[model samples]
Target: MPQLPCQGCRGMCCGPVPITESELKRIRKYVRGMPLPARSKLEGQLRFFGTCIFYDQDQDKCGIHPARPAVCRAFGLHRNLVCFRMPEAASGEAWAAGEPSVGVLSADFVWNDFK
Candidate 1:
């Protein structure tokens, strides 16, 4: 089957991306030369349930797409892991409509499972 194009999805996959040890290392190295604000944003993303540092909410795209983690690259590519066409939650509209979106992965879901 053909995979759904992820464009215009507003980064639903970003929130659940599992950062592995090696990916963390790569992200650290990549962010070392970035400005303070950018680095700080990345650091903050390390917290559980926070959005991925590379996700640009404003632009709705990955800031570090070229070097994104393996989990990120593999998201929605498999039979059991396909992306869902949920209503956009960029605003409160989806919630206002009484259709609460569900997260694909839990905040405490072990990232090591994918390694």
Candidate 2:
């Protein structure tokens, strides 16, 4: 069988991702000494939880990505090369219309096959 082109496909799946132990640990470490988020509805809850709790929005990337749990790290998001083409949010006043207008590009992940 042919291998799935993960690199060619950016990590843009539609749903919540699964978390793992090691990744969760890494997040705990990052949050242990960091300050609070710029905006949060769960201020006190975060104190108990630590870290961004989940993916950080501002970066348009994952806060705990490097140390993210396996399931999350293994996300097969579709890669859209043009940075500004994709809108970050999809609800309320932030709803931007349609898919990104940027051309697509493929990348190679040595570890893509590992999972």
Candidate 3:
């Protein structure tokens, strides 16, 4: 699959990510395992309103990428999750959650939620 041109976009398309229970648990574990300095840096970033809490604005990528939710991993590869900058990357059918979402990352969850 083609990669989205995520660099230089600065997480403009990453926002309000919906997370399932397992995804939340995994993210919690990942955040807890991160070194304080690194976590602090990620949490300290001033992202645009509604941007994903784990989006590393300074680095222009996901801060907890390995633990990101399934929907996030499927992004830009489904009709519904198209990246405007790379619309062609999206194909096939729209994405649907395999599990019920516990909450949205940036909205219902926050920096303190992971800590």
Candidate 4:
């Protein structure tokens, strides 16, 4: 299996990043019984402070794994994996455990399912 990038730091990419109305609606269906708080910021061409409640602190995984949104499923693809990714660490312990980074997507975190 592919490893989770950025094992040295807590997953920062797990924030409920800003999303579109259609995207929000679709994901909402999956997360039933809970309000998928669409930020008031999506009214314009931009949104600020998009953060999801599903970001797991301990496991470094999305708590809402089953209902992850489209963007959440497709972030940072087809580009050179950035420098911030795969930073050096004292040990590769996190890598062995397979915990995902918060804000960044590992190359293996493909969006093919969504497409």
lDDT of 3 by residue, 1-115 (tens): 8978878988887889889999999999999999999999899988888888889988889999899899888989999988888889999789999999998888998888888
Query: Model 2: runs farther than 4 Å from truth?
Result: 1-15, 36-53, 77-115
Across residues 32-110, which tens digit of lDDT does each residue of candidate 1 receive?
5568786455444433245654566666677666667665654555434445663221223111212222222225333
Q: Of 1 and 2, which scores higher on lDDT?
A: 1
lDDT (Cα, 0-100) at 78 in candidate 3: 95
Off by over 4 Å in 1: 1-4, 35-50, 86-115
As for TM-score, the candidate ahead, 1 or 4, is: 1
TM-score for each model: 0.54, 0.35, 0.95, 0.42
Candidate 2 vs candidate 4, lDDT winner = 4
Largest lDDT belongs to which candidate?
A: 3
Error of 4 at 46 (Å): 27
Q: Clashes in candidate 1: how many?
A: 0
Q: Can you write out model 2's per-residue Cα lDDT over 10-36, one digit (the tens) per residue?
A: 333312433334433454565443555
The alpha-carbon root-mean-square deviation between model 2 and the true structure, to one decimal in Å, is 16.2
Better of 2 and 3 by lDDT: 3
Better of 1 and 4 by lDDT: 1
Worst 10 residues of 1 by lDDT: 89-98
